[model samples]
Structures are given as C-alpha cells and as structure tokens.
Target chain A: MKKLLLLLAIAAFCMPTWSADTKNLKYVDGTTLTIINKPQHDGNRLRRINTDKYPDLTSRVRHYLNMPTGMALRFRTNSPVIRAKWTTLDTLRHTNMASISEKGLDLYIKQDGKWLWAGFGNPKFEGTKHASTMINDMDTTMKECMLYLPTFMQVNSIEIGVAPDSRIESCGDIKRAPVVAMGSSYTHGSGTSRAGMAWPAQLSRMLGVDIANYGTSGQQKMEQFFADIICDTDADMFIFDCFSNPSPKEIHERFAPFVKKIRSKHPSTPLVFLETVDREWKNFDLKKRKFENDKEQAAREEIAKVIANDPNIYFFEPGLYTGTDHETSVDGTHPGDMGYQRAAINIAEKINATPALKKIIDAAKAKDCCKSPCKCPASKK
Target chain B: MKKLLLLLAIAAFCMPTWSADTKNLKYVDGTTLTIINKPQHDGNRLRRINTDKYPDLTSRVRHYLNMPTGMALRFRTNSPVIRAKWTTLDTLRHTNMASISEKGLDLYIKQDGKWLWAGFGNPKFEGTKHASTMINDMDTTMKECMLYLPTFMQVNSIEIGVAPDSRIESCGDIKRAPVVAMGSSYTHGSGTSRAGMAWPAQLSRMLGVDIANYGTSGQQKMEQFFADIICDTDADMFIFDCFSNPSPKEIHERFAPFVKKIRSKHPSTPLVFLETVDREWKNFDLKKRKFENDKEQAAREEIAKVIANDPNIYFFEPGLYTGTDHETSVDGTHPGDMGYQRAAINIAEKINATPALKKIIDAAKAKDCCKSPCKCPASKK
Candidate 1:
C-alpha cells in the first residue's frame, strides 16, 4: 500500500499543468497590448482621438471620436488558438454595413514579412457583450499578430485569450512617424465587411507605416477644432478627405483657415488633399449632381490657391479610386471593400509619384530600419 | 351661407385626384407586377424552388428554398418617385452580412441599352414590416425597371407605390429562355452588400439574358431531387456549383448518378459544372487545406469520366473569380461583391469562348429579335 501511494504521488507531480480546452486559456487585458495607429494615447486606447482633450468640439464629432475607426492591437504569441471577449459602448447596427465590420474584431497574422488575414470575431446579434473564438489548430510558432478593433462602434472593455503555457508579449511601438488621415464616412469604413479592410488600415499595411485614422462619419465638416487636433498630432504627413460632407459655402469659409492652422504648427509636414469621388446616385439625380459639382468646384478652387502658395502641399483629383464601372458602392454613396482597396492603392501610387511626399515616406522607412543592431547609416547616426 | 358652401364644394371637385405627398401614393401588389427569372410558376412567386414540388428534399433545403434568392419584378412607370412597403416572412439577420442584402429591395432602371442601379430600400433594423422611399425627384419619362427582392429572406407581402396620377404597367416576360444556376450560399448572395450584386444577377445583366437562381444555401449537396428539378427547368444552359458542400465520399457516391439523372431527361441540353473555389482560410489551416484538396481531387476524377463520355457537358476549374490579392472575401470562405463581379465576368468569358455554349446563347439572342418590327432572320421566321 505504501509503495502504491508513493507511485501515485510521483505520477501526479509529473503531470502537465495545461489542458487543450479553450476554457482553460488565460486572458490578458487588451489595454496591456500594444495599441497602434493613434495620434496620441492620452485617453481611451481604443478610440482614435481623445474627446476630453478638445471640449469645444461639436457633440457629434465628440461622439464619433469615441469610436475606434482604424485602431489595432499588436502582440506576439506562440499560441495556436486565439479568442476575444469584448463589450461595445453601444450595440450600434447599420443596414448597409456588416456587424463584423461595425462592432466585431478582425485578426491578422504576420507571415514572412506580410500580414495575412487569419480569422474574424463575429459579434452577437442583439447584445453589447460578445465573445468569439478567432482561430485554432495551428503549429505553435512565435508569430507577430494584429487584432483590429471595431470600425464604427465604441469599445468599453476587451480581453484577448491565449494558451496557458504559450508566451505572449506586446510588440512595442513602431519607431517611425505615422501618417494622419482626417475624413468622412468613407474613411470611417461605412461599407466595408471587415474592420481591417478600411482604407486607412490598408494604407498602413501597404506602406509599412502607421496611418492614424481621424474619420468622424458625417461630422467631418472642416471644423476649427478638428484643425486644432490635427495641428497638434505627431505625424510625418497629413491627408484630408474632408471635402465630401461639408457644404460648398462651408468649404469656402473653412478650407484656408484649416490649412493655415496646421501649417502654423508643423510647417514642413507634407499635406495631401483628396477630391471627393463622384457619388453614383448623382448620375440619375440632377439635383444631387449640381449640389456635388458645386462642392467639388469649391474644393478645387481652395486647393489650387493652397498648392500655388505652398510647395510642400499637394492635391490629388479622384483617380480610379472606385472603378469606372459605377457598381462599387453599397447605397450609391459609400464604396464597398473593393472600392476601399482601390482607393488605398490609388493613394499610395499618388504618394509615390510626388518627390516631396516620397522623400517623407522614405525618411520614415529609414528610421524603421534603425530598430535592429545594424550598420545602416540611420542606425550609425 | 348656401352660396359659400356651394363655392367650397365646387373647388373641392375641381381639385386634381393625384397628390404629390408620398403618404397619398397608391400601392400596387408586387404579384400584379411581371415576375422574371422563374423556371416554373407552380407555387410561391417569390421562392426560387417550390417545396411542394420536391417533397423528398431535406428540411433544410426546403426551408432555404422559401427565401427569394434572385427573383425580380419587371415594370414600366412614369412616376417621379418610387417607394416600397414590404413584410418579410421572418425578420432574419446575419452578423457577417448586411441587413440590406439580406432583407432589403434593390431597384435598377434601364437607360439607353443598359440597366443601371438607381437606389436601394433600407430595411427596418428589427421588424418584419418596412417602408422606404427608393428614389424621388426624377423626370416623368416612361422607364423600364427591375426591382430585385431580398436575397436571404422570404417575403409575406410586398407593395410598390408611385405617384397617384402616374402610369404603371407590367413589362412582360422576356422571349428568350433563362440560364439556370444551382449552387450554395455564394450563389445566394451570402457576402454581397445588395441583392442585385449576386453573381447570378451580375451574369444576367452582363450577358443580357435571364439567369434563374436555384441556390439553396448550405444544403446544396447534389441530391437526387435537385436533379429532378433542374432537368424539368426550361433553360438554355444549366450551371452546377454543387461541389462545395458535399464530402469527398458523398461526391464519389452521388456525382455520376446526379449528372446521369439530369441527362436522362434532357439528352442534348448543355450542362456546365463549376469546381468549388479554394477557400482562403485553407492557406493557413493545414488540415482544411488537405481536406479541401482531397475534395477537389475527387471532383476532378468524377468530372474526367463525364467529359470523356459526353460531348455536350463542360467543366470549368476555379479561375480568377476572386482577384489574386486575397482581400475580396467577407469571410474566408465566401466572396464579397468584388469577388462575385469577377466570378460573373469570368464565367461569361468562358461561356463566350466555347463554340457549343456560344451557339446556344446566340440562338437565344436571335429568338429575342422577334419582339418588334424587324428584318432579322429570327423575326422573319
């Protein structure tokens, strides 16, 4: 009996601590993960811009700021399975946009120098709190990963789960300066099917630099407070997709001051203005055509004046952002995932075409190269 | 007092019968309109395939058939405004698909020689009954139009409204035979943002022929009953997207019998089989990769035997139906609108490239020439 008891105790001591069941997985607070694509990490880590810092902004703009449009959490882990539990501030839903893009999470794994989509976290139908198993059953290799937050809903709390014995750690911040984008619903990812497919997120992955999104839905009307926020942001470049929502009169009144305020703070930072893509519904509605044409003309006039005066400022007319087929939009106004992809590539091409913009992006890339122990000139300096 | 009353009565009688307010707009039952892209009108006008005709089908297949996958209402009207009121059979919602694509109505207007998207009817967030103004403030020119029904929800009742004084009439059925498509959720527009963006609908518009959709969601397993329905369908061509849902063993057991059953009824009908698309998630999940590879190999082996014996049968492997960039799907398995667009174009190209298929399509076009006064050979006959 003594010998048997001793053998049982020895076996118990040698048993492994972890189990394969996902219920045994350990969860880490999302805030502890490396939050990326934000101009400043002052208030909520999930939100793109802090509302408390600018109290004078319109209530609508402040509300929209609470939603994380293009934010992502970066981490490294060797766990084969990943899970997420989160609560949205409001269980908001849209008719034309999928709930996965509006309030759920999207996961991407970095494989061999490229980030590929791995899985999606599906949101509950009618609830604020939701949980989903993102991906499972893979060889446990240390992999860098990104989890994109909700594009059109605010987050209250989030937790990421990994295997009990796996190593998980934050991927620290990117050393290079980020590109700041301010715009309307198109930039807010209104018609995309996943959060990571948003144009700003696509631009970041394509350029290998951070692109902080400050899209405010229908509230991006070139407000002075927005200019105040943009001017103070730490960025290598600024892009404005702000021409779509404001009235022609408002554009005429606010365009010059908005540009001047940003220039006053960061005079040498490259600024790019994008003309609004023509809405598909305008083809049949003459009234909308005239209204949009007037707005476009006003934007062109203001941009022409700014471009002539400032050598660092550049303007790009709408290219094949949404293809010429006129079948890319969901509600005749908001472009779907395909349009967003085309828009990202078109914007990148435009940036590469200009020497000034290319120089700024190249400089940022050089700074990124200095992160490792190397003999590169940037590292040596 | 009597004189004043008489004058009031006279004024009331002189007033026009029609009012500009949409509240006063007259409603027409959707069934009164010309229904298009149906194989046989034996049961419910909205459903793709009637359950009563195929009692042997699985309950899941029967349930999916109740949803109006690609049915449309054809009409002509001279109204400045168009509106719709509908009650869905069940107010269903999906997390990964938008409500607009699941339950809402999409309107297209024929202009010159092409059908162009005019507007979309947004469904109520949490209700069975919904009403919306699809379009307003257009010139009162007589226009032919198509209104695509919900792709994933069944309709209990639907009514189209127009200005009280406007002329509205049915635009009778097309003279040419429809192309019948049988498949899974992709053909049912699972990832598309609107009902009209489904691949079958896109194929119809691109080819200028009616293409009846018989998609049954996750239940398209190449069943013997499905073969009975397809064999009886009045079609110029039959397309099978049936290899996705079945297991390799099921395919080995059912594929030859399923094809042979259809061929038994129609000896010379052109039959086309589409190989299942490679799921994007398989690229990362090795288990799924092997499983899907096995299924594909089974399909190829079975198809090789059929093609060797039959000359009228054709097979198409997965092409660039979704672009190579791997960013076109909403879920890893289902293609979004861009992917559907690519699939439609690719399928159309394949059909035109083949002499046997092109000859059949051309014959259908020639028959369509008899619609009006003409000197064409088909019209003379």
Candidate 2:
C-alpha cells in the first residue's frame, strides 16, 4: 500500500504545473450593440428594402436578404482567444464570394489606436446552421477589438466568447449612426476581393463610422421600392451612387422622387450624390464617351433641382473616381479592391469636406473612443 | 431540302449577332514574353531559389514552388477578348487560393495612361487536362493591356488567344525592369484577397515595372542559398521585407551578410531594407513589446552599417503601416488586404522618392507607352 501511494505521488509530480482555468464567459447580442454597417432592424431580419410591406419582392430582391454588407462590432476583451457562435441563414453561391464573403466573421482590434485585422472565423457549411468559429492564439492582454459580421450572410444571432474570467463589453464611446449607401453592384461589393474592400467598408474604416449598404445589384433604378425603404430606414447620412444602373429617362423621372422622399422623411440628415465613373473605353469609343458625358450631365441637373432649396443636400459633381485607370476595376462595371480604395478615399475626402457631414465627423471624434495615450500611427499622423 | 435550308437560315438569323471568335490563337512561350514576376531561366523552370544547387531543400522550401506570386505581363491586344491556357503543377488546398489564386488570371489594361482592372479569365477544369480560361467581353478597341500571372501554381506554359484579325504586341514603350522582393509569407501573398493585392503587384502597377516576388513563407533565415540565388537574379531594385520570419538572433547574425552579398554582386542596383512593423498588441503585452522593439533595433543596426557607405542603398525605418488598428493583419503575423495596401503604398512612395529609382521611373515615363490623350484619373491626378 505504501509503495502504491509512492507510485501515485511520482505520477502526480510528473504532471504539468499549470492548469487552464475556465473563466465565466459572457455573451453580447451584436444587434443590441453598436454594429458598424447594420441598420436598426426588426430582429436579425434586417432589410435594406421594406420586405414587410413588399413581402412579394423579398424573393426577387436577393440583396435585401444579405446581412449588412460591411457591418462590424467594436469591443474590449481581455481574453487570449475569441470564439463566436452564430446562426447564418444563407451563404453565397459564387466561389469568390463564398471564400471571403459574409459566411465568416472577420475580427480586428485596436492596436496602437488603429484597427488591425486579426483573423477570420470561417464557416464550416453553407446554410442556416448553428456553427462556431474562433481566433485561438490571441494576446491575453488585448483590450480593444472589432468584429466584422458576415458580408453576404444573414446572421440571426452572434455570441462572442472570451476567457470565462475575461469580460467582453460594448464600445460605448464610438456611437456610429448609420451612413446609408444606395447604389448598384459597385456599392453591393460585386468585384471586391472581400466584403471589407467595398467602397462603403473603406469609407467606414477611414471615417470611423458605421455604414448601411443598401446596394441592390442591377436593380438600383431609383424605383419606388428603394425610395420607400430608404426613406423609412433611420439614417444620419444618405449617399447615392446609382447612376450605373439608371438610364437617362429613369434618372430624369425617378431620381428626384427618391431624393425628395428621403428629404421628406429626414429633413435634417445629410444627402450626398455622385455621377458614374467615365466608362473604361470612353476615349476610344465615342458612343460610350457621349453616353457617359450625357449621363453625368443629366444626373447633375437632377441632383441640382432636388437640392436647390434644401441646404442639407450636397451634390458632388463626379471627380472622386479619378483612379478608374487600367488597374481600378475587376470588370468593366464593378470596381475591384483598388477601385474601391480610390473611390472610398475620394468620397470620404468629399464627405469630410462637406459642412454637415464634417460636423458629424467632428462630433464623433469628440466621443473619444480611445481616451488613453494613442501610439497608433494614424493618431500620430 | 428547301424546308431544312429555311430552318437553318432561320436559326442562323435568330442567333446573336456577336459570336465568340477563337482565332489568331498564338502560344507564345510565356517565359520568352515579358512575364513580370518570372525570372528568366531554361524555359518555365524559373525559380527564386536556385533549386539545382539546393535540390535537397526544394521540397522543404514550399513557397519556392509558388509560381507568379506577383508575376504580370504587359501587352496590347485588340482582340475584344483574352484567353489563357496553362498547365498548373500544384493547386493550393485552401479554397480561397485555389478558387482565385493560381487557378485564375487577373487582367488589366492601360487606359488613359493608368492600368485598369479589366476582368479575370476564370479557369474551366476538364479533368486535369489543360483547359482554357477567358474574358469574353473586352473592348475590341482596347489598345494596351496587362495580365497578372497565377500566385500559387507552377504554370508550365501559357497560350494567349485573340481574334484572328486582331494582334497581340509587346507593351512597346513600357519597358519594365524587374523589382525583386525578398521576404516571407507576406511577400508570398498569404492573406491577400487576390494575387494582385500583394505589395509587389501593387508596386508594379504604381510604377509600371516588373516584379519578381521571391517571398519564401517561413524560410527567410538569410541562408546562403537564397543569397546566392537573389545575387544572380537580375533585378533593377531589391526590397527586403523578410523581418517577420527571421528571429532577433537571425537578424543579428545574418542580416548584414545577406545585404553585403547582394551589394557585392550588384553594387549599383538599389537595395531597400525595412524594419518590421510594431507588433499589434505590443503595448498590451510587455514581453511582446520588448521583443518587437529589440528585434527592430537589431534589424536597424544591421541595415544601417550596410547602407552607411552605399548611397545606392536606402534603409526605410518602419512607419509605413499606420492602419495597424486591428484591420491590417490576417493573424498576428500576416497582413490582410488592407495591410498589404498600406505597406505597398508606403513602399511605392519611398521607392518613387529615391533618387536612383526616381530616375528609372522618369525614364520609363519618357518611353510613353500610352502615347495618347491621358484621361485616366490617376494620370490626371
């Protein structure tokens, strides 16, 4: 008996000294928190088009089913790892989109005050299923972090996990009012390498604000459906880049109603309008060149009349997409990563320069998300 | 017979006016052509690490097998469409890379003096047989264009196709000198959304130059084998971003020798050395902070000595990555698309400003590849 006890003691001595302690984990609803690109929705069935009133159109307008395209959540955590549990309704069919789209959750954190991308929690399957993903090797001391929700998937609920003992809290200071973008496939993130490279996503990163992407591919005709949905949706700012999908007649007819309807609902919110980029072969193709020029002229005239009395509306006469060179687009129509980057920088600069939008930006800065000494180069710059 | 003729005539008349013409199909040895990232060798066996001498290390060094990490081709075609046929030796297991990386070809064209993203020639698989990939709808009038090679596959040979009447010519005035990048996975394009988003590819687009990405994933130990290979490889400029993989001790021991060897061989060739970015969570973790600072200091000291007397060599201290906020990285180590963009812009700007590089760039611009009225926003800007 004594010998057996001695053997047991020896076995115990050979074991590892430290133990992995499971702390009390906490769950936070992404919807209840400040999600960057998510609009105020009735549950996770967030709609860019009013699906409740136009239930018949839900199946036709597939984009409305897609979750907030570039939405992200900023948080503080002291865990060595971040685990997420989610219920995703749909996954993209395109191999490109499926690879980097909203089927996964992309994680970022404030490192030196700038948002640095960690890794993503890739999904395991394609449909509505309870799946979990995680970033396992995180620095335990990490405090400030951000989580980008799926770009093309409808997330029913998301639960973020830290060490049981560690806590996950909402980023209180960074209050992001929705910045709504209404446009065609370019705004819908068609050619982007990932959801985050969309112009709206880039603009959000630059401006440190939330964006609600209301991009409906091939369907941005400034139709009554979009106007009705966008006007009713709560937004701080509205940007229109739908010239690609609308014809001269449609622009002349429907553009004003869309703008006026939004103005009627949110009289105080800022509205920004942009003309389409000059076609890729505009110089070589005279017909295309003429079409592009005429379209811009018509768009400018329409926007001018809509904002004539409204001081809150701003019309930017199409110079922001200057980098639409040979490297900017993925297809003739949709902007790729570089195109998105250029457009975002151009648009963000214009928005920053606008008096009303600039005021909101200044107010956001005053919120002071990072109150402590910032070592981030962005802050220093 | 008359009724049959009538039916055939009806079918022909009803058919679409435009037909996909696969003529003037030329199988130019991609190696002989101005393939950007590929180093000239005995046929398509172009390698960054001289596999002949280090045959034992070939299998161990995985990234050396990755073809066209940043390889691109600049050409002019009026085919209205572009198709490619390649024999890819290896396909990445990762769905993202396999889907978009080596299995695809990214095409861009010179428009208004800037490179524009045209579209990709997506591969069509035929049970391991060499199948063709194509971009069906390009402007037949497109005079100048560029093509980026695969990132993760060893392309044995490639065949470029055009319309029978249209011709494919070299980018006549746009002579591209090789810009060689030596580093780890970041240079190998681990987290980039697409191959073109890699820093080397971006730099090539920005400068209108060829790039040879010799980015070895985790084998940047300043080994004699790599030094020998890099020394012999022809390059106009050399950029070293291998800091992520090398340890502090390795930096202290091998950094100077590596730089010195390259300097000895190509004394006039510009060498750019970089310090690593500040670790994402360095402030939060004291140990990590110390390690990062120490590693950077060691690397700086090594580079400083080598560049002290060499006016041709430029040492860039780490300040390029400012958006490290939480969005710049894929994991704690690799940079994602945004990070790559930030790094590329910084490096490109520095290379542009360097006296030696600026002269070369000026000379390339003087070549006047476009030779047309520049309307591209990049040129205008």
Which has the greatest DockQ? 1
- Tens-place lDDT per residue, model 2, B141-205, is 54666677666666666767765556666533223345678877777776554557677787777
Poorest lDDT segment (10 consecutive residues) of candidate 1 chain A: A372-381
- Model 1: per-residue Cα lDDT over A1-381, one tens digit each: 997687446434433333346788889988877777777767777776778889888877887888877888777776767889999977467998888999989888876467788888888878899998787655566677788999988998999988888767775543223688889988888888999887888877787777888888888888889899987788889988989899999999999999999899999788888888668777555456679899999999999898898998888888327877777888878888878888899999999889888887777765543122222232100
Cα deviation at B41, candidate 2, in Å, is: 1.8
Structure candidate 1, residue pairs in collision: none
**How much does candidate 2 score in TM-score?**
0.76
Best by lDDT: 1
* DockQ score of each predicted structure, in the order shown: 0.52, 0.15
